[model samples]
Target: MAKYLLLKHYRGAPAAVNDVPMDRWTPEELAAHVRYMNDFAARLEETGELVEHQALRPEGTFVRGDGEGRPPVTDGPFAETKDLIAGWTVIDVDSYERALELAGELSAAPGAGGEPINEWLEVRPFLTCLPTVIE
Candidate 1:
């Protein structure tokens, strides 16, 4: 099975929906969302299809080439940058069609209302390979 990366992309500003915003959500609602995500993960695990899943921090450092001994470094939480990647999931699948199918299901991950977030996800094939030297 080939591996694929399902990446989350947000074109607009993200809704303030992090776990830290507990004060805004009722306890039951929060619990439900948590349950959904956990259940989804568990289901994948049971199927032996889940490779790995992770949510990434928005913060990231940018390095630019300076043609010197050291490259220039910049701060994170990049502002107004288009095509920002939110999170990713790596799964093993047989073919591109199967990968797409998995991606579609991943996009439907449970959110606050048991509804899809409608956010775009970028699915790219993983290149798992080792270097070879030919003489």
Candidate 2:
């Protein structure tokens, strides 16, 4: 099985069908959205496809190495950045088609009014380190 990453972006993605911001959602709606995401991951686990999943805080700093013995140089979380990844899910799937199917399912998670959000998720394959012998 090959590993794939499903990336959810906070910015730089096309607008979703249900474009209302989470802040505009009612408390119950927000809760339902969260529950839907959790349930999706749980179902993946049950299917033995889940590798790992994580949600990242929006606040982050850019840092660079500053030579030996020096503290790393740090910069602000630039407000003008084009893309911000909100979260990721890694899964071991048998084929690229399977990964695409899973990503589509995730993009269908419920949003406001319990309607499908139709969000876009960036899917990428992980490069394996193992060498393959050609037949």
lDDT of all the models against the reference? Answer: 0.66, 0.92
| Residues 1-135, model 1: lDDT tens digits | 788888775434355333233346557756766676677667777877788988877656676676678768666556777556667778787788987887776656545454554445677887779545675
* lDDT by residue for model 2 (1-135), tens: 999999999988888998878888889888989998899999999999999999999987989999999999999888857588899999999999999999999999888888989898999999999868785
lDDT comparing candidate 1 with the true structure: 0.66
Instruction: Give the per-residue Cα lDDT of candidate 1 at 97.
Output: 93
RMSD vs true structure, all candidates: 5.1, 1.3
- Looking at model 2, the pairs that clash are none
Candidate No. with top TM-score: 2
Per-candidate total of colliding backbone pairs:
0, 0
Once superposed on the true structure, which residue ranges of model 1 sit more than 4 Å away at CA?
12-29, 65-68, 75-77, 130-135
